[model samples]
Target chain A: MFYGYFNGTIAPTDQLAVGITDLGLLRGYGLFDYFLTYNGRPFQWDWYWARFQNSASRMHLKLPLGKDETYAIVMKLVERSNEAISKTGKATPTDVGIRFVLTGGYSADSISVEKPNLLILAEMIHPVPAIQYEQGIKVILDEYVREMAEVKSTDYKRVILMAEAIRAARASDILYQKGGEISELSRSNFFIVKGEKISTPDRHILHGITRKTVMQLAQSDFQVEERPVLLSELYDADEAFTTSSTKKILPITQIGELTIGDGHVGPKSKFLLERFDELVKTW
Target chain B: MFYGYFNGTIAPTDQLAVGITDLGLLRGYGLFDYFLTYNGRPFQWDWYWARFQNSASRMHLKLPLGKDETYAIVMKLVERSNEAISKTGKATPTDVGIRFVLTGGYSADSISVEKPNLLILAEMIHPVPAIQYEQGIKVILDEYVREMAEVKSTDYKRVILMAEAIRAARASDILYQKGGEISELSRSNFFIVKGEKISTPDRHILHGITRKTVMQLAQSDFQVEERPVLLSELYDADEAFTTSSTKKILPITQIGELTIGDGHVGPKSKFLLERFDELVKTW
Candidate 1:
């Protein structure tokens, strides 16, 4: 069951009462974040809303609610979604994902400083296959540039286009490259393993919720450094992987024709995968 | 009265439905286009849908409808939106805009080879303020390096964020620069005039619908060249203006702290504006 939030109610997904006139839909003028529910509760809820608020602030658009109040709105959506899913016998509380979208108000004859539109949605969670833990996945390299190296907006023309190449390469996903350096996958953070160390780009891409969790998860296993990753380093790495809110941890086995470190998922990837799922189950 | 197109008939915007697991919402995986409706009919409909088709094909996302069929869907949206407005006794047939959005479908486990989700939305059009064209408006500058410059995907974060600066800068819009050369504006195409020659960076930004219109409109009045527009040239131009589907032709009064070309609307900009509107009435 998908819950649509508009007019301060939990309506059916098809009954969404918004249109292109909503600034977010019109100009791609809104910001949103996706987070998963574990044990019927949302994880890292603060970071998700904070990013949305930060993005809205950057646009100078009027958010419908204040910080705490905004969180309250999302909580309302989560609750409504929980109730709807409960009515379904096939689903459980822990099997849901949530997305919160906040769009700047519709364009007026000139400009109106009115309140922005808010829509919070939820659905069943989709997790990548577990076999990727032992075998790793191949990734075709995306030879395009992301529209903005920074900021989060609704225009997904680049990322969605790259998802197919990921499947085509017989690879699990893609490593987004711009000017020969890797940026991100379709909607995930990328990491390269050098010996026992983990490195990633510093906030040049969307700061994924899972990527943050992985950094926290790695404190005990290896030191994680955030920096610009060079393309040359990808070829020499002992292991590589991409992280996102949905997939959690996806190991990259090959880049085009060349495979990384004997062309298989590395030992460190498995270790991180185990740690990731463990946190999901325990935390 | 916004008509949301699903599989078959025109439905209420609120009743419009998309699957919960659709890739469009999940991965931000989709391609879309917006067209300015002239009077009651969509202008340059072929160009608009062509770009959508091209973007979808490049990204390997399937379009739910072909060119002629998609065209019919948009026309349905326009007719319904105009009716909705006239019923309220607030809008005229001339006031309308069209948007077509197509997302990859909700297939389980994989997204590359799934059926697509499609929606067409239309609403009353809002023109720029009458004063904006006469006196022009100020603009801010920013940058974002995207992964895919050629394919149109839904990833729009950079300019959306920079729009905040535009608001604070007391400007109406934003233009982006790459490696010190002005690439394009957030929603409009950037241009700088030096005497009689008008120059702008091509292919770095969306070749805006109104932008192309102006290029044709300027054939007899001034030289329109597609090339890398330098920062120095922008700072020293005799006049500057931006073009888009929404704003039509807008002259720039200032960029950053520097006053543009006598710090007011220039003669050439006025000429182009008159020419553009002349074309719009018949466009």
Candidate 2:
């Protein structure tokens, strides 16, 4: 039984609805942030919350609940969902994914809304297969640049429209470039490793929480550069990987027609993935 | 009483709701086109339908209904709404506004939806006050450029976020500029009149239907140039105006601190407005 924290109470997912006049639906005025929960506890909740607040502030959306209040609501919803599964004689999954969405509420003008609607969804977590990590994934180069690149607004039309192009390239994902500089993937941050050094574009990309954790882990033992990365640099790099909440640190072997450094999962990615797992277990 | 043609049925506005899981609500994946109905009839229905189809095509969104089929749905809904108002012992408004929306339907991934949802809304037309047309309205300059400028996607966060700045400047709307070149207003297309020549940015702007009609009417007696117009040109132009479905041909008296030619509605704008009225009456 999936549970959702809608507005102020828990409800079935199917019963959740937004008015047609809500600015979020009428004008696409909304923001969303999501993170994972491991072993019945939210992983890096503070980091995700900070980023959520930043996104909302940038979009001029106001969150109705405070940090602690919202945290309590999410935990309550998750607990209730797990208990419901147990009552049905089913084993509740220890890991789950939670999404926090803030939308511009009902408005007659369809341009701006004074109040905001907060929606929280708790669902079973779907993990990427271990084989994909063992064998690096392929990515294709795309020339699309997202608008308001820093904010995590609920506007992913460019990525949805590029689904066919990505699939035709026989790649798992896309790495976006604009003005000759590589920005990031459609859903993850892109990084290149070159002989003891790792670098990724610092600007015009979503500041992923997992990316931040990987950067911190990498900086402790390896040289890390946060700056503009050009397309030419990726082709010549020793290894490349992407970071996201779902994909912690997945290695990228092929980009377009070029293969990166022997086309195998690099030792650096393996080490970082192991370190990330250890950190998650601690959490 | 307002009525909405939702999917294949007409319903009350209060009952019109979209599921929270709809990709249109979750990811802001939707497009909307609206025009006014005059004398209980949709004005230029064919022209509006063509633009709607074009917008959906650009976004790779498939319309669930054919153009003629959708036209019938809108007319039926309008007729029913008028009948309801007449039964209430009130004067039925001859003019109303209709909005046709296409959403990417429900999707578990929230990125793509196979089936699209078509929603048509018919409501009382809110006409721009005659004072605004006679005395002209003020506008402010905005530096943000829309992504996928050709497709009329439901992403208006930039304008909503800039609402305060526009209000502070005592402007009715904003004229967006990219790289020192004026693109268009938030909801209308910007135009400038220089002596006998009138020009507007040909690219990176929504091709408004009213703008098309106005251009056709103006071409009969005046020079029309569809090219890039810079900010400097707007400041020095002899006349300026904006055109949209709701606001037909509104003169701009002031942009920022600079007052447009004589700080009143210019002669060209007055002439165009009269011609537009004549054309609408003919329709």
* lDDT (Cα, tens digit) per residue for candidate 2, span B125-227: 7778999998999999888788877788898888898898988988999999988999899989989998988898898898888899899999987899999
What i-RMS does every model get?
4.9, 1.2
* Candidate 2 stretches greater than 4 Å from native: none
Report per-candidate TM-score of chain A alone.
Answer: 0.89, 0.97
Per-residue CA lDDT of candidate 1, range B125-205, in tens? Answer: 667888988888987766554435444555454555565567778888777776787877766688888988988787677
Task: Give a tens-digit lDDT track for model 1, residues A101-120.
Answer: 66665555313435676667
lDDT: which candidate is best? 2
